[model samples]
Target: MTEQRKDILDMLAAGKITAEEAEQLIAALERDQAPAAAGLDARPKGKVKYLRVVVDATDNGEPSRVNVRVPLQLLRAGVRLAALVPPQALVKANASLSDSGVPIDLTQLKPEQLEALVEHLDDVTVEVDSPDATVRVFCE
Candidate 1:
């Protein structure tokens, strides 16, 4: 029905191209356009707003799945809130986190840094596959 498809059929009708050749051309055209047609939600890479974690596993021989979508705006807001906390409280929180093996400095959390981190996350995707479980982490 498309112009290119019509052209291919016309070529076949005129005997300029064989039926097989016309079929191949139509198939190639569909393949080339499939991604663009299917990607209805395509967005700019820099505009990634959610951090997604998806897990599928067999638990006790029963299949289970987990899908989590966390908005990047929530993290940005948390970072902004951290700025209002007293320095003494931040130090205590940092120490507690370190004691718990987190090793993160709460005082170092800045909104700009979080934004930059989220932007970089757009380019990162992590996948873990095993017989029992599969995990995927990406930005969307």
Candidate 2:
């Protein structure tokens, strides 16, 4: 449990707050911290550590546009295959991603899910600059 969670529990145990209050506190904490790193594979696959994934997409002659907090593993895989995508193979590639753990939910992905995602992605790199908690996918 996080220090904040422990503190919340302790407060409830001491009757400083009611159970409902404790639950609400915990939920508040989660929500406040959720959006910044919310995504499957946000952390290193299989670990509870906090992380974030950002996706940068570019179209013909256009500058890149980014989607933040994308699933680290899924985006890792997608970028790899997307670079060499044969137009008709996108669906198959995404299905393969489903096998890895990209979780259609997009909130978080288990390690197994990340592994599943990796298996389907043809070529991609997952880089972690820990201080930043961001994963950058280079589609080539």
Candidate 3:
């Protein structure tokens, strides 16, 4: 065990820190050390290429299912295309979207922002489960 881990354990044994506090400290240490400790495993595994959504549901004795996989490259292409659209058209579209309760401004989107969003997507997985349905959205 590392000296930090030993210190944490000693603190716990001495009642100087609560168990939960010790666990949290250990977890933080592990997260901080993971990349260095991983060595060869720290290399990128693979690029995320797709955004996926899956749904399964039953409603009033009827069942439904849906599965979707969207290419990440398509999103990049769309962002590029958005730049080609006329500003007036983008304004109109933005107004329409607002009217439809989508409060988004197309004119504000930037390539760098989109790239950041794509990077963050790799760490995001959304899942919902209820008595009647299950839904998941993630990147792969």
lDDT of 1 by residue, 9-96 (tens): 9999999999899999999999988887778557443678898999999999999999999998886777677668898998999999
TM-score, each model?
A: 0.55, 0.31, 0.62
Poorest 10 consecutive residues by lDDT, candidate 2: 44-53
**Can you list the residue pairs that collide in candidate 3?**
none
- The best-first sequence of candidates by TM-score reads 3, 1, 2
Please report, as a residue range, the 10-residue window in candidate 3 with the lowest summed lDDT. Answer: 75-84
Residue 97, candidate 2: how far off, in angstroms? Answer: 32
Shift of residue 1 alpha carbon in model 1, Å? 49
For lDDT, candidate 1 versus 2, the one ahead is 1
Model 2: how far residue 83 lies from native, Å? 23
Error of 2 at 122 (Å): 9.9
* Local accuracy of candidate 2 as per-residue lDDT tens digits, 26-93: 99999987876676437445332222446444456564545444444655566455455454565665
Off by over 4 Å in 1: 1-46
Name the candidate, 2 or 3, with the larger TM-score value: 3
RMSD of each: 11.2, 15.6, 8.1
Task: Give the clash total for candidate 1.
Answer: 0
Error of 3 at 87 (Å): 1.3
User: Alpha carbon lDDT of residue 79, candidate 1?
Assistant: 65
**Pairs that clash in candidate 1:** none
Error of 2 at 104 (Å): 36
Candidate 3: C-alpha lDDT: 0.89
